[model samples]
Target chain A: MDKLTPPVSGSRYSVIRAIIITWMTLVILGAFLLDIPRMNILEHTARNLYFHVPMWFTMMSMVLVSGIYSARHLASGSRITDIRARESARVAAVFGVMGLITGILWAKFTWYSGTSVWWNSDPRQSMAAIQLLIYGAYFFLRTTIDDNEKRGRIAAVYNLIAAATVPFLLYVLPRQMESLHPGADGNPAFSEITAPIMRAVFYPAVIGFIAIAWLLYRQRVRVAILKENLTSD
Target chain B: MRLHSGRTSWLRATVSVFLKDTRIEWRSRFGINLLVLFVLSSVFILVFALGQDTVERNVIAALYWIVIIFAATSSLGRSFISEEEGGTVLLLQTHVPGSAVFAGKLLFNLVLILIANVLASLAFTVFINATIANWPIFVVIVVLGSSGLAGATTILAAIIARTGNGGSLLPVLLLPILMPLLLSVVHAMIAALEPGSSWNDVGNDIATLVAYAGTVVTASVLLFDFVWKD
Candidate 1:
């Protein structure tokens, strides 16, 4: 009973891949091409709603995937489940980094312009960075444990505990303090539905990015399985 | 019948573990000694650096919490690390329920934190000449705040034991877990020590600290067995 063999052989997902490619192309086209209402200081970068925000949505989806796989890994003690958990976290981290960079770029030109401040210490920004650090510690923990199975179970428990922190960090902690970000706990949030035009591109952009992240996660898991099987043999 | 004794021994084992841990501390004063020294020196440093009565009440509260947190980081990982380093972890695992072991360690950490903070608070009052406008409110915040810190770190310490890396990794993992607890408690402490501050003013921050403490302890109970055994 080799653990790395596909639990079900030949799980092909090429068709879904094609659909994501097509949807993402359309979302990208709409994001830049669509005319958004002009606002003071925010001018045109508000279209970042389609790009920057979706990066988080996709990152969060991968985190949820990572958490589920971690839970299953503990229950079944399967290396494949462990690999899935690990790879998804790695990919989600990439997206999280991208989101942070893009958020900084967006803020620099708009909110912090003339002030030379890349980071204004906003609660939302600080907490999101901390959330990423929590996951970073998860990956770091994996490297410190040498035993394969022990690493899996321990990292899995840490993953569950880390996932428990996301809500408080991303949503709960930020809301507790005042911030420039819209829809903070203190402010009335901008309901995406009110602006039908931006919402049109925003929803698809979210779906498309999440779909792309799923593809990347699947590819990494496949490679991990082959490596694990080869080493065991 | 065996099940009944199993339950009884579980409670008894936890108390024994708690006793053994305190005795070990009493004998060696390993982490606790370091903590007490850390507390006093930091307070003395504060007095020397900031002139007498020149500091604001809120600043004093903040400084006290910072000292306590650093002191906690120095010692709170000892409960699990002591067992792991002594090679008694597996021995304990065989007899005591994981929950019982965690309960014992958590009890030890809680008492340790309470004593250390009270001593630190006293040092702050005497040496730093810190003022406390609301003693009862400040006490409530300190008790809840310390319990939360202790509970969160105990599980993390168990997790940290599995890693090959030495003690360096504990603080990295601990900071994020302690953020919300730290933020709310600092605010509550600030409010409690400020002149003319009332219960209504500090109520929300205190509530946040209580809620954070409650959730973290529940999480420790649920997650400790897996971390302890695996």
Candidate 2:
């Protein structure tokens, strides 16, 4: 593997950018154009499976990238690595908020239709709220400190912890509780229930979203590194 | 003067810090007094808020944990900030290992949280007329949940103490980290308070709380060095 292929610090590739944009455009088209069988519950809105689910996967990947940088920052005591961690977390937070907003819209129409409620408080929803707050706390923590090095080190500790708690908050605790979303004790995931024709779009949607998410993180890291350089000088 | 061995001295230093913290707190009575006031006020507010209506076991359980969590958040953060204020942080840092300091503070936090939780729960039982059928499980939940709370508060206090705005950052950072533990404990408490509940009914939640406390305490010990040394 080339050294430039790494997620932390990578050279820009116009080729990859074009591919991701094209792929995501296709996904957007497929999301609306694909023929999904009408369901008793979701009806046409079940098409949201392609968009809403991948948001979380993309956010999780961003968090993983953040944790990797956090661990690297701790081990190496490098400010640049810490910058990567912080930027990655910021990008992850953007995706997480997007995931949440999209979730609310999807649930609003499908689950809580005709009700005035926007926040239905599903188990997954509850845990995601907690997860987001935990990340939000990281940025709050950063604001309370003044020194750049100290802020990075301290926030890196918090970032690591926030990442560590993700599985527990997002998966373990919610899985144990009764919930409307899939992966509960009795209810299998929508993936299992999805039609064969839908799989084509679904797979591409997930891949395309994840690919674009990676690009966003990479760009964010580039800017962050540039900021760090400008500030240090 | 004769010197003690290294291991014994470290243990002695830890115990002494724990006792010294207790002694200072005994004299000031700040945390305990504030905790009592907070707990009593919250319980009174709840009583007035709920009125004479019969509440479900779930609400009672939820309210109980909410009060304990609030009390822990308000009080437990002072452990490290006091040292910071007194300018003894540097003195203590030069003398003890981070693990020893963390252990000492954690011990004090656990005891303090336990005392506050008991006092608050007793107030709840009296004022709110809340009763639990399974006493032992309720006590277990109290112990385990507060242990996790204390663990989180202890570490968070160390982090917050270093910051300029220690007061507000405590809850913002501490509460979310404590959410998983709090969720399980509240769930278990609801089960334990229900009439038909046995240890069997709440076994999973109890296990989760225990694991939470263990994990947080261990993580604190490892992370304390980073937070405290600076």
What level of docking quality does candidate 2 show? medium
DockQ of each: 0.55, 0.58
- For each prediction in turn, the share of the native Cα contacts (below 8 Å between chains A and B) that it retains comes to 0.47, 0.42
- Report backbone clashes per prediction: 0, 0
Clashing pairs in 2: none
Per-residue lDDT over A162-225 for candidate 2, one digit per residue giving the tens place of the 0 to 100 score: 5655555653465356676776757888778889878889889889988988788778777766
Question: In candidate 2, how many Å is residue A151 off?
Answer: 0.9
Q: Mind giving the per-residue lDDT tens digits that candidate 1 earns over B5-32?
A: 3556777877887888888888998777
Clashing pairs in 1: none
User: Against the hidden true structure, what lDDT does model 1 obtain?
Assistant: 0.81
Please give the lDDT score at residue A62 for candidate 1.
Answer: 87
Chain B TM, every candidate: 0.92, 0.95
